[model samples]
Target chain A: MDHGQIEATNLIDRYLTNRATPEECARFEEHFLDCPDCLSRLESTRGLIDGLKQQPPDTFQRRTWVGFMGWIAAAAVTTFAIFRPPPATPPPVTIPGPTLTARAGPVFTLATVRGAQADAPIVTVSGEFTLALDFEPAPGIKGFAVQVTSGTGEQLMSEVEHPLSASGTIGIGLRSQDLKPGLYRAVVVGKSVDGRELQRVIFPFRFQVP
Target chain B: MQSSGTGQSFASPRRSRQDLVSAIVSGDRSAEAELVDWFARGLAIILSRIVKDHQTVEDLRQDSFRIAIERLRSGALRDPDALPGFMAMIARNVAIEHLRQRTPGALSATAPDPTGGPSQYHDLARKQNAAIVRKILNELPQPRDRELLYRFYIADEEKETICERFGLSALHFNRVLHRARERFRELFEKRRSGGGIVPPLDAPDR
Candidate 1:
């Protein structure tokens, strides 16, 4: 807090900017050791630098601070739950959770997206989505299929085969070019080799694309 | 740009995966190069865990990526979101098969028994060091550079923010971000090696 400390505090900015010369760095270091004030200043500046570096450059907050985001999400959810309401008399909306088989998991599904425009290109849409699936790998059998539905509520595609070796995104390309864009949904039904619906897991996900 | 409907966090992985797919499908050579550049280290890590020979692992790492690219081109890899993971699995299985074929009786032929032969600690340590290096980049002098590095590369920010701030199209932003990441990687590598912070990774150099 004296003149030297005051000067040292300012010198940090200079050193960081690389404007400080070797002599200045040496001078700063010598004073830094003797004066606790400069030492604290130096550490604080380094801390600031480290803080700045680790931050997600797009935002002032760093990723290490990402833990706080959980709280934010919680707050949003809480607010939505409190303030958001159902559409006026929108007859008791029903979410149909898919019927689970006797298997341990949900069934695998293959699907595609379309646009409202007749010429709406499939290129505008994406195929990545999560599947609630019942995995019943029959030893050496490589592929399995459930069913597929088009955006128009029609069974435009079905019996799509997914291999066991493929765990991530299995590619079901737009096999048919004559697809119109609209709301599409699929019901993935499955059973084990014994033809009994398994029941261990029934994970389900819903999403949309343009 | 995506709608505020989905929010930012959810937008990134989906959007970028889409960008990569679009670029590859649209026949952008630079996108292919960028994908290779970003994934080289990840591929190397997968290769190391599988292949025993150091030289062979590096070669196989490159080979698997080439295979991945071929798959992308041929539409074998239909979904872009799982591209990297799929490629790694292919590399992993290939190495396993090669080891089994080479020496069925040799205990060392397959990947090291995950239990103890190799130091899993070293693997963890390397990951920590990389994280620390990422931490250091934010400490650099330039604010814009920090912003670019964090959002574009580390946090894996989507194309939207770049579009907002820079007003660049997807292709333009992709080009810029790709170069920015390269510069940042170079800086990170320099600091990492010079800091002499972590000793040469002790994972048997495999």
Candidate 2:
């Protein structure tokens, strides 16, 4: 399968919306696996579908009013609202905040700090947060084993063999409350399927709780 | 390795389908990993469309890969070039069997849970992408077009029904979809380049 065939059949859209037959689905998948362009398109289209589903019913609704009658109606409503007495204040309601999951935190990309400490990327994090380590994986490297440590060489977190995204990034969520404000380094080692290390990259950053 | 018009090179090296199959069959670990890496994302996307739960989708993906490897090793696949199609078929069948097992009045066995739930990375990516898409949808100028997208993609309504409801020709319907996808790609590229949360490594920081 090629881009021509993909466009001719509208395979990306159909496959995303579940409108494609099994045969079409198989063919498209096969094509995209080796085709980055198709893979990127598939991701964006899927994003569009997911975004549309998240929208409320009234998202696309439009409201229109007629001519002079519309102006008069609007004025009347405004006048009534201005003249009407405010309703009695309701009792204060205390609603509990929604519990925060690991995903509820803000994500920040951690990059290698090449020069002085003052030039290192500093992130102000409160509560839970995620640190995204982005790197280009060597050919045939599919995953990474990530280990994070403080400036003092104290190990903070370690994750074994996390899969790399198609866009070549891995994210690790952490809590600010767990560590003191200081510099940290993420030791990311690319790994093959058999847990063999291919390459190692270090990202240094500092976090201050505010 | 095929390069796109944009000059982006694919990571997978160019190898004949037969060579890859033969390599895997000869107990080449690199070949196995290469095969998995090539098809993992596509398989995940395909299975995720059919299965709702992230954990279940991941499980099905693994099952598909294992089954495909076993079949290839046994010389069950006649056409080496049909490997992709065969992988897709295996993934779909795995997903279907999983769904069938979960259905009521079917043979009752404890369903397997793989990896417990979706990884944090998957969840984060989904949330980030959805936010970008929502922004694009809101900025869409045409209410009709927005409604058409919602009805077609989200509602899963038939194309003919959508066209009739919107009083559009078949050609127009296709145009709307094409334009929407193009618009999305434009914004997605912008986000990637403009220092968004998940910017590429070389992207300049704000």
Candidate 3:
């Protein structure tokens, strides 16, 4: 191992042994998340801790696995148990014969959207750019349906399943020329099954016709 | 229609941390927004360890970032490289303070506290995790290595003595220990990911 890696291992040892200070542990975390080599090394260090605990008191009872086969088996067992795969999404609800699908909840609720806005957060916009509306859905909201309208309530653009960026903002490609360069509002409506509105949010912004 | 109002600026995702610090200090609105967007997730992870409530976590994240920006403006941080860790420490302090404010005496059982002595939930895994550790330990190649690990870990032996017992210099011992750890991790991850394992680098000669 290189000098840096050795140092990282030492820090890992200190961390696992409960000897690392808050600052040291914090530094270690920042490094490990970005360093694959360090992560693999830490994995082995973790194994040492685990393997030591399974030691039997009697030397005779200290059974050794035959060759590398036993070692491989052990790895399989330990790894599978530690890093279980994420749960599969439930299948879409459908009635057997008629193929009817039913969904609950209101089309959109200001209350629910307000609650989700607290969690996922609503990233507001400024300046002249494509209007983007993104927000976290209240519980059980499957997808979002968004609409943009002018101050006079003229529906300008409507979209379904508009992508929400990692920062949680949805985009509407409305240039200054799209709407006579006036004040406009993007209304994001959250929906569950059956096009039910879970909640709605209005984002108001102004743009000048270029 | 207004042309380039005060709040008018392009939202940019390419701002570097230093750029963010500068922009935030200079009161650039777009830069401030970008700073929040960049640091919020990282802060959320750090704060979530101490503050369980999602609302409280978000609140503390914002508060920490705000404090960090203010500190930067005041020239508190000299090195830009320490930004990530510094930000994390700020978030941690904020969480700790929040806990103190809410419970008065009940500190979070998951982090470091002034009083100390296992008040934090850190490393307090349940029995299942312990069992997993034990299962992995049984696969180690050398019983001596296993013994060495046990003494150092459970028995809490001093490094000086462990090196002496192993008949190696401190530096060499550290290397051996590193290799041992790496080998163990290879086995562990291979097993966890449900992949077939290859030969062990340090498998004991039976």
Leading candidate by lDDT = 2
In candidate 2, the residue pairs with backbone N, CA or C atoms under 3 Å apart (3 or more residues apart, or in different chains) clash, namely none
lDDT of 3 at B74: 78
**Order of candidates by TM-score, top first?**
2, 3, 1
Best by DockQ: 2
Q: How big is the positional error of residue A125 in model 2, measured in Å on the Cα after superposition?
A: 46
Q: Tens-digit lDDT track for model 3 on B1-206? A: 11111111222245555666667667787876765765565465455435444456656777997898788777777765456667778887897777655543221112222222321222222122344445445555654555455445533345676677556577866765766666556545655677434222111100
lDDT of 2 at B79: 82
For model 2, the stretches where C-alpha displacement exceeds 4 angstroms are A63-210, B1-11, B105-123, B190-206
TM-score of chain B of each: 0.47, 0.76, 0.44
Candidate 1 local lDDT, B59-119, one digit each (tens): 6767777777776767776666555456556666665665555543222112233223334
Score each candidate by Cα lDDT: 0.39, 0.60, 0.47
The C-alpha stretches of model 1 lying farther than 4 A from their native spots are A1-210, B1-15, B108-206
Q: Write the per-residue lDDT of candidate 2 for residues A1-210, one digit (tens) a residue.
A: 667777877888777654566577666676666677787888767666665544433353331111122334455675874454433331111211121111111334443321112224434533444565544334445467889899998989966456543323466657767778788887788776677876677666665544
Model 1, A1-210: lDDT tens digits are 243544534465444323344456444433332333343334333323333333322343232122233334455675774354422321111123232111001112221111011211122211211233322222222233545456545675565644321111122323223344454443333334444532212122232233
TM-score between model 1 and native: 0.27
User: What fraction of the correct interface contacts does each predicted structure contain?
Assistant: 0.00, 0.32, 0.16
RMSD of 3: 26.6
